[model samples]
Target: MKRRDCLKAGLTLPLLPLVQKAAAATGPRPAAGLTRVRPGAAGWPGTSDWDQLSRAVGGRLSVPVSPFLGDAATRSEALAQLRNPFFIGDQPALTQTSGYHGAWLSRPSARVVSAANSADVAAAVNFARRHRLRLVVKGGGHSYHGTSCAPDSLLVWTRAMNQVELHDAFVAQGAAAGTAAQPAVSVGAGAMWIDAYNAVTTHGGRYVQGGGCTSVGVTGLVTGGGFGSFSKAFGTAAASLIEAEVVTADGRVRVVNADQEPDLFWALKGGCAGSFGVVTRMTLRTHALPDTFGGVSLKVRADSDESWHALVVETLRFCRDTLCNPHWGEQLRFGDERTLGVSMVFQGLSQDAAAAAWGPFVAWLAARPQYTLLDPLQALALPARHMWDADFFRRHAPHLIAEDTRPDAPRMRMLWKGDQSQVGWYLHGYASAWMPSGLLDDAQREAAATAICAAAAHMPVELHCNKGLFGAPADALAASRATATHPAVLDAFALALIGNAGGPAYAGSGGTVDEADAREGAARVQRAYQQLRTLLPAAPTYVSECDYFQRDWQQSFWGPNYPRLLAAKRRYDPEGLFVIHHGVGSEDWSADGFERRR
Candidate 1:
């Protein structure tokens, strides 16, 4: 059934009376100040109150069932399910990442409102606010910083709302009369990138800018300045946003766009997630699909430090002169083991063209006797329409994809084999810094290469070329500039990301935590990132994938846009009803977002 049809059907249910009663019982609204109530607190809701909430949301409210808990057989099931992102997302409490050292561990909320529509979300918001309860939001449950789950809090779970619809020429609800309609797609907050790709690209023969990870939540990605494998070609996912349907802190359903609630709309694009409001659904502009999409992979080991430094210098020069354009994206890895790894993607290019593009660099490496080729340099191209087609991979290259093995799972639901390591991994430390495009200039290339080698001396460092917009098209840069993302990205040639993590380690999932190793790894990752920071001291970071303990997050994540975002926060959610770690206006509250400071 269509999403609109489902919403219409849901509205017919008797859900209004409970909402009214909950508001009425709260009497005069309390001042926007206090510590939220947990279970057994003086202001905590009773059984009857919980039952009323359940009824209001059409019996969708329930105690979250944690896979980490239960008996031996259940524990075994949990271990197996950790490998499947689909199974993990289906659970009320499980996050795609288990946790980060000394940061947070994934914990289930006391209760969850498995919302199916905007009305249900509003009901849950009203209940949480009226009862002075701590609230959490979860969709794809992929938060690396552990923002999606909290102990003893109420969860607004949108996992049941996954829906994807395409449009030929869609206009925002409040767009001007003469506003030209554009191709777009409307995605439920719970929908993953794979779902959007399937609907828009695989079936509709179009493209929607989204995250590189197919299982990432659409809403979370766009709201947090998302990047994809082809971002250099299409810009950021946030820049493609047309409109959104959001549930605000006051329980009002708002349709925000450039013409309506413009401030909120701007904030919604590239602003931190779970801060402004609860996004029920969003519409993103789509683009024509390129005929072919492809990738290049090569791994080489350097025999000596001297050779490695030369390799780094040559690689940077090659990138600046040839691959630093819209056609190239993805990473170039520098490891502590004196190795250089290349895993990059290209759009609008054929196998031959892609091979030729890397020909000079390949030949340069071949001439260096001190460098040994660890893997055969390969360039592969395929029909762009089949890029996310699970059946295509299953039939042609089964090793490239991992299917959802459950009997009831959809055939198209699969995870890239490369992404399997991150399924339930626990982060040690992660840090990213935007490297200025000038660093690749003839005069600065040597300095940049030196910093890279020094950084890798501590740990492996990857440069995600697509995350920066230095070499992007003008229109793409303009759209990104208009959003709330840090301006540093606009002038950056690449984002240097360094991190380390351990295997799956949830509390009761039978996975053991290696505290000593985690601490040591965290230190190493910090040292590696600091080495790059020496080159670009004031570089800004991508909010979604930054350090857990970032000190100057306001400047690091949003830069000059923080004050504006804070204003939007005050205007739309004055009471701080929605809060996440390091999110806008979070400084006014405690770390866990339970107690208001000022």
Candidate 2:
């Protein structure tokens, strides 16, 4: 075959264009370095030889996948297509299950599947089912553990299945004074939270959910319990769900809602990472539109460690006690310095009311006279409107301080390993213990804070808890556990590591030493987390992206619902299809932790 054809067949290494062009521009070569494999036409595992897999899936999927198979320029063209087919130059390098927040390297068995619509997803699911394949569901590719993409599994990518349908009745309708259900919109599982937000606003409606980052996928956030600034005004992204269309393991599609499939509906809402099924679409009750007033409030600096610590504690205390009780939105963010910032929002209200609601904290900041505080609302300027005011401060602080002087700041990768529970004061108890730890001395603390500040100066850490959205009905969250699934629910803390892009590379470092250091760092983090675990009203589990291989993960994410989930799995995915890599029905897990029938 021609070199371009070989490229189309999944030779992803960046090659010299001249060599490929000369070969393809001229004629086919007898042999090239490329290993030809064709598992399936769509590039799923277990279908064909690697060499011929591209043509098979390309032919089947019926998209311009060949562009991905060709030479440098041709493959680049194909990748571009994959990014955003609706918009030009949006396709990204679709690595099978890689590119998670903190994932540095992925195992070699990685593969990719791109779905253009729900039909394609059905086909993908069927393919995996027939082949008895282990699958990973990819929506936005942002999970820290990269759960959507797995190392040793067939990846069912859903990024291409983007669609949104809004409902006017749901937005306008209210809970009947006596008994009534609100109207809701139907959204494709692949849609981003921002898309839903825009749709709700455009339709003259509003949605109350916690979606910290606009780019986060609605499916993952909603199903996993989304938290955001608007959460206080609303409830949780999960709470707004009126219904959802999910694809079960048996390749059967079903609509789950409170009144429809009560158990499954209950499981779908905060049931843990993914126990019930692969959600293809969601029906969400939309609220009335409200004018949102929010921005970043600033004035904390790097040099003042004591002042910074006080501010962070005060802010957290204020939100947990003062703000959460009043149903107001507020978030406190601290960077690697003496810097303190806040992102507060008031839905459907004017700036004055918001100012008054935030009066106590504002007054405290002003009276302290320790640092300069700016009006976050006023500091926000146009032309750079993409960012909120709080984010702007995070980015600018780096330039203010000389990079060389910020040595103590450890510019390391950031990975988030967090969980939610009925316990509202989890952080309150944990923070007290962590502050005095010898992790950072006075000077080191200052330097580290500076480093964090510098990094925030680029991409600010989004404090999404402005909504005080945690502590859903403990009984409801607990009810998800029906059996002993691999990952249990209570222990399931959705974890993601936000690694710094283009940060540290251990190129020349001794391999053993670097590995040991990483292990040490990981251990330190684990220890600290264990300390925090003490505060859990109960021993809530910590779910890591890397924990996919563990059999316990199912039980951890699913909690008490594991048994019923397995029965449903037997009924739906008897052959074990449509499983999430690190999820309940995943085939990668050994049968060690499953509850046996007596």
Candidate 3:
């Protein structure tokens, strides 16, 4: 078989390519490579193969099996864990459970080798390579593109490898000469952000730049250039990375760091996980914990179309400029029916500084500029009473910084549901993109305006940015000396203005819609937002947050870095054992995996 052909010059944007139905890959004449595997292909660890794999991994394999149905006790426990579609990272969620954000986008292969350590992982890789089977690496199991798990592949489940270690000084050899080695945290790939957070706090004052959600896996977040409230203050999660222990395609455990296997080191950070190799553990730089402040939850309610658009634009601006102190962080959420909610926090900002920072933003929200000269009756933005009482906001806002995932914390969701009390709903889908800091050009804004107005219903959207991620001794927005996060991350935080965009999908009446109309609606949504992506050329969406259906995905995900990344992929994974959909070397594989792309 052959590798990806990306030598074609120039960027070609395919806004939305046709998604072909799954078919077993065949008819490939790529010399020197193994047979290409596809979804629904017939091949696997049949009973004997399963037993061998189980033995190889010391009985760590998990497969679908029937407990005598008559045994009520065993059956009851099994049903609670295995069949739930939305269970978030519970041990027995979907074979392809999307870590903490289980989207259930694809069915998973029924078999998984729950490898405990790097040696076990290496053995599994050699097994998959020997059989020419499609493989997926499930570090946190949370995959936006579903690359972490697949339907007919041998999955390396790393959920059990939850280990955390802290070091006082992590000397990075390849750091630019003047840079000093800093304290570091070494976390297992399967460990969640909370685990790392606990370790940092226990170490006394340090914190790692990572997911706001406690359950988000450190490995997955960093792989896609992790951004959070603290990111602007520190840098991206990827940038903070100092070292990693990886299991490569050749079944060797390699220590990858700036001085070790530098190219692989570069590819791992922001180049994304699963595309290079399985990262068993990661060591990242940590920052001293600073004083943190929280802002009140401000709700902006708008009853009309003009009001919603203006509110979203203004709120984003507030986050971008008005309150954009490097030490401060906030979340801007847009809910259905033109409603906007904001939750903010700050660290190391004194009360007086905090008040000064919130001053202009609050005043602007309380008194909005009028958009028209004619309509005297319509209040400019949200009516006074409808806006969350500003005074109340000033008094009751939170002091917490990172997400609180305790049982009663608002962000906590019980991944394991024992009864009807758990929340349940269908997620239509979630799509996001990065917007460079700037107003949408007229045409782009108009398109969003038109789409939102015609949309069947209100869409939940959010605009998030880490003002701190853009800071530095030099220019925070400039490329970092530490890790390989895309430089586009430093561009103004303009979120692709997704129409009907982000908090959560609004579920409607229980009636089902015509499948054909649903498809049409999806197409329309894709076109409307895809156009918006075109306007913001400077800023690319975070690879982890955005959908993979954009035009020229490789360029959009990684600009000038694509060529270099492709070269590295060719060098490290020669047979292309690691492939992320639309990732570095993925151009070589067809979307269906049935044919290699030219």
Candidate 4:
């Protein structure tokens, strides 16, 4: 039988013995309360209830067991697996990021629904709602704010739902009769950006805007205002969305788009994941491929504070004039050690053109005797279709990619070497702010440069150029404006990120967490962000990558769009069935999302 047919068949079976016993004990409906029930609590579902659910979902439900619960040798193997994001994703109890100090720690759910299709997801959502259980949704398990994992919860794990398909000509569900069909790709919620890139770009010879890190989940990234290495050219992943299949709190399977349930559709586009519903699949518009994709990398150190300030000012001027367009993206780092780092990517430019664009800046650094070249500048370009081709990288530039070493792993299962550090990182502190485009103006450029240098005195600060739409094409900006992301991004030149992390320190994983150093690093990171905020006070931040404990998250993450998002949340999930840290309507619940505010 087909999976969907099996789901229908399973739901019709007689109630299991345990479920019947539990139904008799608790009556027909769940008890009314302001708090959710945890394990061993009154009104909690019985074994029979879970068994019935498992049967309904084709026996996909299972109790999650932490790898740390195993014997010494088993634990060692688990620790080794932490370095591989694919391995971490495959484990129900693990997340790409282990935890954040004093905020949230990655913990396994009481049970997990390893969903294989939308029917499985609907079953899990219905079960959680009926039982009044704390529900958690995890796709790639890469939530930096720990939104993907929670203790004493029922997890809808979508990792096994990965499936990618291409569409040559697609139209919205209820478009006008003459609406033109557009090229697009329909991606499973559980699929990572790499999976989409491989299908849409590497194989299909097209482009779909997505996260810079290949391992980021497609649904999670889009729902949180996704940005990629080429966002300056294509806009956000959310903006590229054409349609989404979502399962709301009431278990109604909904296909939402611009012409149907438009509010919910808008909310799904950059509204914040796990707020409105669980997305099973999404169709995103694809663009024509550029001829080449390229990158530039270099490092320089200044001998004195004066030189460092000069370096920062000059670099800002260069970015404002030359690199602010659609061709440029990625980051430029300013470090505490009086160092400047260039780690940027480009699209539609040849090797010589890209190199020539940076010629003046390179000459300026070389002319200064106090500036020493720490890493020689390198500018390179390649066929755009080969950008995400794992085989191409492995054969030519092995150092640029890290492959999954498991003998059975797919050959395409690889991540950028630079992203390997984040596989199981434990966050000490992290914060981000949008730097207004005005900062690049001649009159204010010095102030912006000064703020950067001052912030770096405490910790490194990275300016992600593509996160802001200052120099993007008009259509890209208009599309972003139609989404739920903060309007501040429309006028910003870059998003400044200041943060630090330690190695994997998951509890009981045999990895020691340095409390003192973590505390100190957290303090420094906070101070660095504060220094930048002094220049651009009340600047908004990206919801996917922002301060975990932000006091005014509503304003900082969505600005004026929060009210609209909250209304959509009430319309679709009035009972507050879905919740995540700082997500829409989250203020109505406690920190752990277990207790109602009233």
Candidate 5:
């Protein structure tokens, strides 16, 4: 079945055996007290109004005419789904069935128009403005807060706009028109990192600092100030953003770049997605294929506090060196109560050079009696793609890719992939996406270790790190100077340290995850990370991966740029045509779980 069809099938999927009643319970409830979730009726903008949206698009318009969802019932429907079987079913989330949506957070917009080109997007925007209907665009819908989806809104799905091209002879502005500009690639809004990488490699370079995962859309990642463990050697991929084709809220299609609409161009780099406008295509710089060799995955169990302490101390030392190496592209996933693993790869080096660089870290880990190294992709003489089965898993956390061959491909978790055994809360889509700015200093690291030990006592403590992803301040500063991304990006010691809360699934007969569970899980993780977030030198949060619950999220995510971004929003989207929680100027509006009230 098509991805959207599979996702649509998820809607009527039988409620988990446990949450059959209370989970899907309708009507007003205490948890929803703060914001009322009223069901939709056939009163406003009925079928004829929706038919107009179809006329406005160059693609399909998925309109659920049922009164329960067509108008505003999605307010409650969205809230309820975020709780139970919706998020923790056979699939932990509304998995990315299509390019535009990495998360199944979308509800019945007035209609879901699958825009095939820029004109369709322009038409949809004009229609939304004329009717004053809420307009939401789904660009690789991978938001942690699920901001891409909204109730009683017009959802423009850009998933069908998947096309890629290479500009081998193009020259950038500022330089003499004839000066040799770097080779660049143009990806459609629906293109993913894997797709971009695959296309680029076929032409030349095997690497493109697109995103951490394979399925993550290029449009969302690049626009949100992306970071890749593999790209640490190449700096942020967004730094390569040379141009974009955007359909602004004013219903005008303009090309934004360093020379044109410079302000909007600057903001689009890291101001997060869906704020300024909807991009149809993006142009990013690509590097020549580097000669990388020697990749390995090593792991040891921390079954005891003493073992855990040793692992923590060793981690501090390894990072001290790893963080300093700009050319060392490695992946490390640690913090689970009983395990500490490191996946190291040396790019732009020979086997001997690679060994020399990581030999100490490897030997030190091996000599430790407390460590039990598990070697899977320990191929010592191949690049990541040649060594790993899935190209997406290669740049991302390859250690998690099953050590043993499986009969079927791994199930996708939002934009990434995970083994079937872990297709639960730990997956990308199942868990909340947060990028905090905090370092585990001598004093802080110890405390964090203690907290981590407790948090991961039972389940794996999911974490991600690489030589360049939040390795230190210098890396972030370099990335920031290139765009208006969050200042926290510079301050954060790690790209992300997901708070260890909630569970894989609530298997009880009628006690599956609920709205309260979601709120609590979010709060619990926030409190856990707060201890370190408060100590950071600056507030840094990833825009592509966002959560509204953060303290001063706007300031934390955009830093000083938030003011400028707000101004830009006011200028381009004055009517609040673009509204997303935690997005620029979102503070001007309030939500009652339904339409945006002026």
Candidate 6:
């Protein structure tokens, strides 16, 4: 089955009907005493009416859609001219455009506006408030559970809000302040990591809170717990936050930070996903930039069978265990490749010593005589750059790139889904894919090894240790912060290249892995996370991994901070006129009814 088919199967869970009924009972009930707030419909409006909404919002919204999402002649045209709005239908291509490699576009109920400025976001929020409508906020559209954008729900796109503000040595100022009085940055929610990186780096090698993927949005990434390469050396992205500027559901603009709206400030840091409000900008602490060493590429073959897998798996496990050691600054990416190479970067250690320290892993791969490591730095002399501003995205995209592209392989088909596991050890289960059948176990593994060798023939598998992937130290960030409630959350990215997946455009790559193959690949990943949990026994928890897993809004992402968030919501949005998809504040029921009336 294709990945979409498996995901579609997920919609058919036995308890789906019961879940829907239960949701209807307590889901987004009509606000008490508020005639304006009506029960929202379950799904989005039809696709044909999308343009009417685009025209309705008019210049108030900023999105990529060119008035063609609803009237395009072909799928490509529709996708090319797509932008988000409440009445707009879901764009399948844009669904999976999130930070996590695993998370992909499933289907949304409706589209929302992508803001270019704070006023634009304010307009959307206020509009929702006036209409008693539900809203969803998207920054980089990278949430694992597709929480950022909702179908039928009024969506707020922060992409147009991408702006980087650089200040003096101490702090980088953004247009949107976390609070009215505090000195913070006011960033457009849509800005990507690379944007921030360039802004900071251009101004005297300064550093700000960001993550590994250059394309991830600052708003959603920080709110959902930003993790990146510099994290272990620095801290989780949220810890560096000084303030946030947000547009409340009731269309009120508030600044949240340590001093002003302190409770809301606490909520905004890690606790605020799409709930509290639309984060238009943030003021983040700045760090002096440091000279670092790293690389991004793919490694395929190793001398022996056990050595290649062991080198990849064990090296990853070791890196995870020793992340806080201070001497190592690393990120990893391993897939259907051999001898995955680590893009090793070290700041605390000397250059010569860092290379020597990484020598053991290198020697291990070298022992695999059959393994042919294609070091990009050695071959093409490409220097390792940080994930934030690297030139990888434009080159590889949808799926192929310099890191793992095969020239003669079949076209690649990729499906990405995200999960967080609490496992700490790494393990392998080669027997599962061919299990039950066990027909060509030996021959298959060998062929697999050959393929691995072939892929690595061009470039080595570079371990891009996604910085800040793990939630911040719970003790340091506090439960009041968003990530504190959801500790050990790691972004698991699953990517594959297959034939005929991208239609006829780039089908000549010759590398193709279909749905069944992808499932097997995912199973391999599951086993890896599960076994790693045994070793470290502290892997991140993925909401989709378990059947009973439900994103309770307050608990899974916010934890014990729900009461405080609810209190803030009540104070800011008394009428409950503005609600959001997922579990946001929809379940709260104060005695006098929902709070905040505009």
Can you give the lDDT of residue 406 in candidate 4? 73
Instruction: Give me candidate 3's TM-score against the actual structure.
Output: 0.74
Error of 4 at 71 (Å): 4.3
Instruction: Give a tens-digit lDDT track for model 2, residues 335-398.
Output: 4445555544444445565556667776777678776664233222122122222233347533
Q: Better model by TM-score, 2 or 3?
A: 3
lDDT of 4 at 240: 95
Per-candidate clash tally = 0, 75, 20, 0, 7, 91
lDDT digits (tens) for residues 343-379 of candidate 3: 4545565556656765665566557643221211111
Q: What tens-digit string does per-residue lDDT give for candidate 4 at 1-598? A: 0000000000011223433343244323323347889999998999899899999999998888878777888778787777888888888988999999879888899999999999999999999999989999999999998898999999999988789999999998887689899999999989998899999999999999998888889999999998998899899889999999999999999999998999999999899759988999999999999999989888999999999999999989998999889999988889868998888899999999999999999999889899999998888899999999999998888988887877898888878888888888888899888888888889988998999999999998888888888899999999988999887888888888888888887778777679998999899988998898888767788898878988577777776677677767877887889989988878778889998773
- What is the C-alpha lDDT profile of model 5 across 1-598, one tens digit per residue? 0011000000011222322232233222222212212226433456676677677663367753322222356434433333222132212113232111122232444466778999999988887777656777776555545566566667777776778888776564443456666678888987766567667763355556666455556887888777765544566667668888899988999888877778888888877658788999998877667665345555677557888766765675566555435555444455444777655555566767655666776777667777666552243554544322354454655654432122352332232223122222321222222323233456555655564555444333344444124443364357546687755444334444443322333121122344465555555555545443433323355655434455556655665566666656767776666777767756546641244433
Best of the two (3, 5) by TM-score: 3
Over 384-453, each residue of candidate 6 has an lDDT whose tens digit, in order, gives 2332332443454323221112244112211111111100101111110000111113433344334333
Q: What's the TM-score of every candidate structure?
A: 0.94, 0.60, 0.74, 0.94, 0.73, 0.59
Worst 10 residues of 1 by lDDT: 1-10
Pairs with backbone N, CA or C atoms under 3 Å apart (clashes), candidate 4: none
| C-alpha lDDT of candidate 3 relative to the true structure | 0.55
What is residue 462's positional error in candidate 1, in angstroms? 0.4
Off-target runs (Cα >4 Å) in candidate 5 are 1-43, 46-49, 64-106, 172-180, 329-331, 344-346, 350-356, 365-463, 467-480, 491-493, 499-527, 531-539, 546-548, 592-598
Cα lDDT computed for each candidate against the true fold: 0.85, 0.42, 0.55, 0.86, 0.55, 0.43
